[model samples]
Target: MIPGRDFPGKTALVLLTSLAVVISPALAFAHTGESGLVLLLPTDYYLLGGTLAVLASFCLIFLWPAARLERLCAASLPIGSLRVPSQTAISAIACLFLTALILSGLFGSRDPRSNPLPVTIWSVWWGSFVFVQAACGDLWYYLNPSIAPSRLVRSLLRRPAALLRYPGWLGHWPAILSFGFFSWLELVDLAPDDPTRLARFVLLYLGVTIAGMVLFGEDIWLARGDPFSFFLRLLAHLSPIDPRPMPADPARRRLFLVLPGSRLFHLPALTLSGTLFVLMTLSSVSFDGLSRTFRWLSLAGINPLEFPGRSAVLAFNTTGLFGVWLVVAAAYLGVIALGQLINPTWRLVRAAGLLVISIVPIALAYHFAHYLTILLMELQYVVQIYGDPLDRGWNPLGLQPNFVTASFLNDYHAVSIIWNLQAGAVVLGHLVAVAVAHVLNARLGGTGWRAVVAQVPLAILMVLYTLFGLWLLAAPNIG
Candidate 1:
């Protein structure tokens, strides 16, 4: 229980593993016809049922005693020491693997669907990896291909501490900027799916990450500058397993099993930059879903029937991306302002930090709702490509490549199941957010009517988000 210690545990989850959807815009446009997974849109009955479920969960929170809720948030169990492999060995393997993958991207098949790099990056890593890592824990701590090699090289050479101290004022500004640029590359860049171009982007990013690590300390840079690492670290808070660094000795860390959302409660209050970064995550995920809808395209003056190439609508989409972000930020701030108005004692900065955490679940929900089809369908390609990463048509693992066809989705039962799953994730995500807000209310607003009143604005926003998320899934879209 050291103040400002190396690791402090917070227990809470907002499920905004929304990073899964943001990384694969190219795949959003890759499929067509009944030959692919066809999700039947949910009807009005589904939306009504889903919203009522969320509302019921919110009302149920009021019956729980504050102490009882607090106990749930405080729950944790040390799981003993986690034995890990040598960093150098992991790094060497990852480096070799990535190098080969990059070469394949540069020289392999031109078709994006057939190429390993695009599929690996968009489907495997962003789609499946994000979901798995967020649920399980911070796998990136050991397995991130970028960081492992950087750390090994630095350690082998006995790299000195940073020549320049990282400025506190910068906060997570670097990560915020990195995220923005990366989102643009995914959503607006003309040829993100082109294997050669995709490989080039990876190389450029690798160089930038290495240079940043060289300039700042590895730990500091990764925490504040690397977008993927930063994104994954936030998602880690929602995981049931947490890696807590030993306070007295920074070199040592231990694993613990905690309630799924429990780890977030102990994180130091986010800074202004950090708060905005969290908002950006929510905004980015929302925009990713929103932009794909026919309504979004119409706003950009593009006909859904006569859809041009991504290049034609680049400027329009780019504007829409920034527009969504700004609108969401403004709306969020406005809601915060209203909350402060409701409770004169609550400070804006503290309220922003506490309330923004509630949005994580909504982001996570939309991610599953929108991209579940992609993950389920495209994951087959990931398995098939694994044995023949170079596309040599060799099945080294002797595994049958079970490909998902339009026929699989065309089954009425199959479509019904997928549609229900999408709706369930959206509803469950919002319920989780409601529960998170309930805990925050008890902790920050104290007891009685005052406590309930403080959460009113945020609660309303969560409801709206839940409705919006479900609509995005069930709404008719051009893609």
Candidate 2:
């Protein structure tokens, strides 16, 4: 096995022990769904217990010296590598298929289940494919439909020159806007599930991406202009595999079996815009969970039983989404400032950038927990639709059963299993965040009692967030 260093046994023991304590039977239970399978909702006891578990972990981990953290954090095993194919060919085919998907959205069946576009976009792409991309690496680089055609044309003409220079001042601001807009479309759009509307939205994005690529350059445009690519790239840092080419062989890439969130340790301090982008990422997903809850409806003075569609709460949600982001950003910045106050040696911008990476584990964990059931329930439609994409009763694959229902929640034993999976995902995510914070703190040269004191502000912040996340999951969707 390709190996650089061994992971510290004490660190592993501490983490595993923390995980075990948090995941104990007394603290675990809750998964609300329409399937009549929820055993219990997260009560005050669960929340308090989870908070204590996380806080305790922070204290225990803080005692470990920076030198050991450097070793514990450094362990990586060498995994086998697979050679990638040419980007141009892959991108071209992906573009063609994406175009067909848009056409299908516009002309196919009006029913969401029968139509390929909405299911493909919402369930298959957003729910399923995104998670795969996060774990597997930035496959989107090869499959970026917008970037492909531009490269193909450039290659065909044998002219690989960019017409204009990308301004360094732009600093991914465009991508931030695009990402926010995309989030708005997904969470706040009224007709997101409607096929024709979904198709139009896809088509509009396609045109915008193509126009930007043509005017700027494909590489530069995609890096700054494409929100989805930027999103994927950020999440791709969490994957076990590193997509960067080997230094010795520029054309060949090697896969490393590093711990998740390891790459973030290597990232330099983020620009102001990039830091905002990270905040937006966390807040958007958090709001998505919050907006569906009864508490949110009550706060908005709406009856959960008689809840209106997205149209009625359009302004409220739009405003609330931004407000949620602002609150998170303020809290993060404030906590980092407080931490720096405890230890004046760390630079503010550098501290902000490093500490922000701690949020990656929590954000990703929430995303997985929030969308796990949605993916499981909706992906069946994705599978069934392939047989008759146009809803014309043409089974090209001659599949046996026309449709399948998710029975995982229906069965009592299976419900327990799925609930445990969700709870475990969340608890483990928080624990990992705590561990990452310890490592990051060490990276900032924090050690001993001073280091422990320095971590208090952010550590408390993480606990509060943990409480918020658990509450969101357990909160009934009366709205």
Candidate 3:
């Protein structure tokens, strides 16, 4: 595997497909009664149960043999050659689809909920698509609009190799910046769901992505820079399927039905930039959830009941976003430091990079937890728009026109199931993280007391994150 090969997102998921909750600030309150209804549930019990489950996973790993855990991480069910569609054709179609959406945003409905652009981008793409892509494999690889089109442009221009090499030092900062900006657009910038502004943002993202690809070579630029692609690529590591374990030679790439996260072991160690980008994945989502809480709104001197729009608290959320990111990063690095302090044998960078893979499950969990509701609710609108994308009330698909149903959100038993699933995803993610960490420890920390001692700090952090994640979901907010 090449050092700088592979990427961040087919994102911008990032569930940019949390590009899942890529829940518009406008639609934030769209599901108010449903989320607030969660306040009445026994979420505290769920939280406790989640914490205990994570702790239990940690304890079990501590007792289990290191080699046994390593074998589990290494486990996989071999699958045959993966036949995929023509990359250029599929990606070009994706590009054309994106262009149509951009045009829709420019000429579509004034109401964000009514606009197909925001609904498609946030609801279908970010909300639901990210979840499946992350779980399966790098589905975005075949669909990144930049790759094939830019290659075509490069062919036309008669330039084969890129004009310059993508500086390795720049690392994933571009992707990180992109995810951060995308997060802000979703969280801070008022009127993000507004069709016109969304169109501009998508256009800008496309322009930059295409230009970057044209300038830096499609594969190299996206692998090194483009945010959504960079974000999604990394998230794909947690997927249960391994479609292209060997990217250099496509014919040699055999698919495998592997245990989820078994792919992480194959991934090269993350650079500092790569590691930070991973942190941004979780931090950006964390701040998204945090910024919505009543406590956060009150901190910004806004009333939960008479909440002013995102415009009012923009500055505060902006600060809070970075603030939460810093806190998360600092806490994460600090724990690694403490872990190394406990067991001085492991190099800090090696430990940080290797163990950081464990965080992916938690990041995915957060995306799944926070965004599933939006996906569930907004998807109906997505279906509704397909029946009339131009708002001409055209029923081309013969589906229900403006036939979005909210009866389920209003149904108690239905909501109870959604709430449990959300909590369950969070708990399961942390449990997976614990198991992954144990696997990493088995490989790196030797065995017995020393290994357990070194990992104890991380185990505690996972426990805390499980609680924190559950609380964020259960917490009542202005939305």
Candidate 4:
């Protein structure tokens, strides 16, 4: 672990710079008056900067290989290296928190005043985080906080005499159930409106997930019937570490030949999964934003609702966009599989981080650029409807879908324009990430200059996309 002090100053500097850019008069002009004041809270920039900083730290640790950081991380671990138990506890807490949040939303009147930050952030970023961590590095183990609590419960419930025969399965179910349940909520039951109903649905999902894990051993199927595991075992010949035995007992295992590159083989799945997750998220955001923009145009008399069947028409469009997203995800996975065949031992952590890092410049460029459009477009609406931009009216029941519509359209044209730009930037970001990984792999070096240059394509693309989005925003509103 490098000394904490080594990076704090740099992190602080970057954070301060980001805040200044986000808060500058150039950026805030569109959100003028009370609306601008309300949106200018430091929390928004802090969250954004914090996320970036975490990524930067990961890069530093991986590329530079800091002994101090390693020590710091090691010191944090307990004598037994309590990562598993800690993961279990955290997963459980997350599951419980999610369940409680959903239940509260359902039972109480849907309040429009509730923070939408979680929903938006998750849609854009957290989904990718979960998929990348889970699919790539066996990070699911680290995230299972519920396991700790479950273990505690078992300890309290078990009799001293039963300790000799304690089951190894005691704390596994909470992590399994929490993961499976959250998956169901995101992949199957996500709904746009009727927050209360969605909340109730999520609670039920948690119950089912927890129940399933409790009944089935988390690793039983993997140990018994998973063909993928067998394939991995077969391919372990290329890995530097012994694959047949746990790292603790590698010397005793001769059944499988583990070469130097085995660890790298597992990364493609993470790369593919992370890529797909990001694509889907960006696609969803695009569909939502475009749909809203069109609706506004229709209302303005630029287009007709055709037959007063606005809801049905909207649903059809949304579903079609979702179908497109599914196709993109499938294609991305297919390509990843092909890549795996060519190079099974590709270094994953570095590759994944590099890929994600490469996209940051593009993300930065387009997010700011498109936000400009939303701000410009919504300025008039903000004045007309909200009276003051910063005056937040409370609505406890999230029943009012129009609240979002009003906020996005009325007070934020610049944001809308930026949203469109972001759609293009997202696609470009992925491309840039992949290109950087390939180039860096060829070069076999980790210099800061190279890293910045690797991100240049994405930055350029974002600038172009921003210009296009601005043009669209400036076009006359036909509706």
Candidate 5:
């Protein structure tokens, strides 16, 4: 253990008690997934420090003047340039890859882990690639499968414009709905990881995206209608690598190493729909964590140990998914309203649009914390599949079925390391969120003290959320 300082007696005791209350039905945490070792831990002790760290970060921000912070965020070093290949070529390759995965799903092994499609979608795409996007910048721009097909059709017809103009009033509601349905497919659906079912769903998604692109322009549809591309674009804003098209050659982009989240400094207030989109992103991830908890299963009248499969609670979990999102949406809007009460000049909705970007780091943190174990376990299967593209058991790599090992998860010491790593990520993410929120408030133009005062409510909410995030880590999980 990396020992530092322990929380004082009463404070530590109280936090432990709070953790108990939040995670009732004790020992529920130790039987499932990679979190089994968490039951005997001093998890609440970790939570106390995480909560304090978030509060300290919030307080520390008041010391730095807005200009100094802006300068800090804007600091960067040039990293030369790279010329991108034609989008049509890049997208065609991506499209071919997608087609191969779909074929593999249709004809390969029935096992979800062995199947290339499910492993790639659940483990590779959502698990690892997302973090890559947050580290590097918008690489997905060159890899969208829908773009190549749409562009090829447009060129063949000798018309750059689409069949119809995208409506201005529509906003990002289409993207919001796309994401909402996808969350359901990922979380509540009984056989989301089933190869054949997932392949069909992907086909449906491709058809819709292509039709929308052909009718209403690739750029607009991708930016406003497709869920994966738009969400990745949002994540790209937090990357340190800043890529901008070269003035002399549009094909090449100049890259600079700026501070992470620095791009957010220049982003204008989002539309009302855009704000909801951000909120929904956070809410759906939260629900994903919540739905898997022992507490949630108990509430739905399912025994944690006996654990009826997903088929039994499909309807109940489906409603719970939407219920969690609606509750989060309501609470977020209300918090913004409370903040607006302190500063009457700003309208309720616009104020939310301005500050919502600050939540991006928190959302990304949740993504990492919630899915890290899955990535660790499933990535082994991915490497195995490299040798057996169709899972035909060719034995070229001489890999045994034991290649997908869960031994580390069963060991207490290894599990502790994993848990601590997850805790650290959750804490650091909140600290960055506090800083981002402070910088954004400073952009509103006020004296130092006034700027600090304006963000007090937000800071408090962040602290509470920090506690919640920690609790989610130590909470009893269902699977």
Candidate 6:
């Protein structure tokens, strides 16, 4: 779709490089009866077929209706001033609650003989990677679970006045300070295994988040100008919808409210984000559940816990996590939707669509890079263990007994080959996305191709460094 770009050539090069690194090794090692890991599974074939079928059905059901709805909205809504509410207090409370829950889970003793110090701290440290983004994008405001209900209650209390009143300033520096402090703790590994240290860290984060929201004002921080806001603005370009212009007039605006729809279906941003949140939670739960199931299944005729009960509990917890993630995602969408409501003429749908599309490449690259790095780094350890034939001692760090039963050297080689292939795919995916973005920009009169070209090297280097850091973590080492 991008003009002047040779997709075939780029794709061919990717394939060739992948083969040289992944497939060639397999062929050479074939004589030794060793096979390299293959990324694609037979199950993938069935999954792909099912996906196509579902997509076709969806198109048949909704494509025309969705188009008509879009046209109607485009014609009806008028442009007007935008007014997004402040969410400082709500966001602060959310940060506190979430931090408390995670800390409790991490530090609280689960078994009588088990110590809660090091493991809990390590868990929190790992969690830091996932929660850091909240500090980056005024994400606390969006992720806070209390916001919606609080706003509704406030509205009920105030009646007419609530309609126009925006959330007041709580503070901003507190959040920044909190983020910096936590980042320091994680980076320095200060008191790395101490529960007290982790508790202190959590307290500091909560204190800062709360203090900042109280001092600076959430609405002002969320508006354009701040670095986080700026990045979000740039990311917004990927969205198919626009949130800048207000709707044309009151009558047109009323139509959106009058339309009868499922709550999930009505909120496009919420639906998209919520779906992803659910999928991630489900995948994690399913992976763990299936693993437990297999372990039990292997025991000859010994039925452990009821499989149905175990599955039900897993499902419940998975659903709960999904709900929590959905709440956070919905809060984010709510903020943007408010912006759209303020300016009705804004094409929110198209902007949302584009943003969703743009994120795909980045998400894929992140996942592939993470898993590949893990596989590669682990392979090195496996090789060391297997290459030493005289060593019969258990390798706690090696994957032989833990991952799969095979010659340590052969298993490591297979994993390494797969990792290399995945890494190549990750790199290729990102480069292609950048190029595609540039091409799309040109077509849309956005940034020039030269700008994208200038940044490619830097982007690649950054990706490499990130992957390397992750690889270091993936290797077996005591926290």
Cα lDDT computed for each candidate against the true fold: 0.68, 0.74, 0.72, 0.36, 0.74, 0.34
In model 3, how large is the Cα lDDT of residue 252?
63
Write candidate 3's Cα lDDT for 309-355 as tens digits.
87798888899988888888888888888888888777777787788
After TM-score superposition, what is the CA distance of residue 339 in candidate 2 from its true location, in Å? 1.5
Candidate 1, which ten residues in sequence have the lowest lDDT sum?
25-34
Pick by TM-score: which candidate is best? 2
Candidate 6 residue-wise lDDT at 307: 45
Ranking by TM-score: 2, 5, 3, 1, 4, 6
Q: How close is candidate 5 to the true structure, as a TM-score?
A: 0.88
lDDT of 6: 0.34
State which candidate, 5 or 6, has the greater lDDT. Answer: 5
In candidate 1, what are the lDDT values of residues 1-479, reduced to their tens digit? 12222222332221122223221221222111112235443456656655565555666665566555656556566766555556657766776777777887899888776788888887777767777776988777666667666765677767766646889989889988888877787778888779999898888888788778877888888888887887777677778777777767666667777666656655655676777887887777677777777788888788877888787788888888878888877778788788777777667887787767766666666666556777767766777776666667787666555545445655777865676566556555555566666666555554566667767777667666656765665555765
Models ranked on lDDT: 5, 2, 3, 1, 4, 6
Listed in order, each prediction's TM-score against the native is 0.84, 0.90, 0.86, 0.40, 0.88, 0.34
Q: Write the per-residue lDDT of candidate 5 for residues 168-223, one digit (tens) a residue.
A: 99998899998888889998898888999999888889989998898899888988
What is the RMSD, in Å, between candidate 5 and the native fold over all Cα?
Answer: 7.5
lDDT of 2 at 378: 74
TM-score computed on alpha carbons, candidate 2: 0.90
lDDT of 2 by residue, 21-52 (tens): 65674244222223234436447766677667
Specify the poorest-scoring 10-residue window by lDDT in model 6: 255-264
* Residue pairs with backbone atoms closer than 3 Å in model 5 (clashes): none
lDDT of 6 by residue, 1-479 (tens): 11122324444454355334432322111100012343343444423432333233222222223323222223212223334445656554655655554464355543211323233333322333222332222243455433444444445655412233223332223223333333334323324335455666556544433333233333443331122332233233322222332366422211112111111122223224222332232233222222233332333232434443333344343344344334534543453354344444324443233223323344334434333433334444344443432234545554444243344434666666655555454444343343332232222121333422332332333333333323322322211
Candidate 1 wrong stretches, greater than 4 Å: 1-47, 76-81, 152-159, 243-256, 395-402, 442-447
